[model samples]
Target: MRRAAALLLVLTSALALAACDRQAGPASPGDRGRLPLAEYDMPEDDVRVVGTARWTLAKECMVRLGFDRLRDLDIDPLPGWPRRPAGTGVVSLVVYASDDFRYGVQDPEQAARYGYQAARVDYERHYREKKWTLPEYLALTGEFVGDDPKSVHGHLVPKRGCLGEADRAIHGTVPQDRKDPVLDLGAESLEQGKRDRAWKKADRAWSACMRRAGHRYATPTDAASDPDRDREELEENLTDPEYDLNQPSAAEKKTATADARCKRRTGYVRTVHAVDVRIQNKLIASNRAKLEDQRRWNRDAARRARDILADRS
Candidate 1:
């Protein structure tokens, strides 16, 4: 049941990321070096309004089904949206530079104050104790029915419960079948940037910097996933049974700090961003029709969401 609930949570989060939109203006001539606009990206205000409305509707549906305990549960912004830097009109290098850097331990001092392993311990412990019944979980996730056909409770569930109801109320239909062009474009652009000649030069510079610092890495990804850090973590776990495996150890912290400094010294971030934006702009130009269609769909969904919320109010 817990596993099923976790899967539902993952699905819901994915839906939010793919379906959510924000309003964006046309790119200025001076912004030619920036990442190309995906027509579907919504303004932050629209995202917040739509997100809150969906949460409210879901909560109301759950309450109608006699599940009131969920009223207190917090609904987080869609993944990647909250982390986006403002006014950049892009997910910038700062995302990898600040608190979110090196898997959320960007600063050694911050890591020391709040060890990595300790962050999610409370949430993990709470969920492990079986917080919700299987039926309740299914209903909340809009999959009220169990997967098995022979189950006794199979006939008692609705085809779509609270979450699906909320989606339908907002978008006329659940956007389960739609493909997210923005995510696809972002991945392709990043891969292209990695292979570009300019970025390769930057990677070599970063590698040299790391070598001078007594660490050898071919790329930023390689440096971030150094195996020595893993070995140290294993040793720590074996030596102290009470040690939290999730927490960043001293060795991991040292590696992360070095990795960050190398990134700065080599200007890898600027190099990659420039390459990525150039490649993405070309891709966007080639796929203009498809992207425009996606943008139209997103705008319609946003309108529906606004109307639904207003009617309720």
Candidate 2:
């Protein structure tokens, strides 16, 4: 359930940021060989431009308000993960599968030996620690209405500090009335794919593969959310006082390997990718106008951002 909620949040956030309004070019027959989902995904270049500009402006604002120390303190955009061709598809399935196979565990022996726990621990220990001072935080996140005051340049901060000011300067506070229909369209497409004859046939083949592997899962999702696995986890947590729930156990590693192998053998990922491509192309065609509007907004934003950065430089 937690995984499901996280997936929903990621999808919704992506769709909400769908601001490009340009029409996609007609897909060539050869284009089908490439990832179809990439066609409908957000423009990463535009996002980077606007984000860099916002950071630049916020830093400038902070300096103007007498927090010059933060001027040299590097403020940067959070590094994004390397995106898969299918965008959020694999992430959406994380609820049903183990982390080992979530991104495709190529070497099962290596995965079992090292497990999936090392990187997370390193990330928390290094990147997740507090790296910013209070003034820097205030500059980036704006002021609160009911907080005890902190002095920056011996002045009580105004409501909605540097971050808010920078935001207002670039993209005004009045929210756009438009909504991105991609999420609704994507959901509709998934349903349609489920009913698609080809998808259904592929699903059956995958299910048969799982059954052969001694797992009675009707779908990858079923394997991901296996009741018996959940029950075993619960029992283990209850009985073992020293068990670390965050770390994948031996049983989990075994299950993940089988799940990955079954998926690979049945070509479930390819099937799902094909279905998503067909649906997304149709959605793009129907929603050209909205997408174009978003594109225009983004282009304008990018232009303004460039201008702001240029002036500073």
Top-TM-score structure, candidate number? 1
What is candidate 1's TM-score against the reference? 0.66
The sequence of per-residue lDDT tens digits that candidate 1 reaches over residues 1-313 is 0000111122221233222222112222221233565444444355445656666787777666666687765655321212222232222121011112212223345444443332233223322223445555456444322242222243333445555677677766655545657657866887887888998998899789878988777886775556776776786588786885556677766656676666666666766767877887898988888788777766776787787778877
Which lDDT tens digits does candidate 2 get at residues 82-189? 112233232211111222232233344544643443333422322222345545545444432234245466765544555555555665541123353443465676
Scored by Cα lDDT, where does model 2 land? Answer: 0.51
Clashing residue pairs in all predictions, respectively, total 8, 9
Q: Per-residue lDDT for 189 in model 2? A: 68
Residue 194's C-alpha lDDT in candidate 1? 84
List per-candidate RMSD values in Å: 10.1, 9.5
Tell me model 1's lDDT, rounded to 2 decimals.
0.52
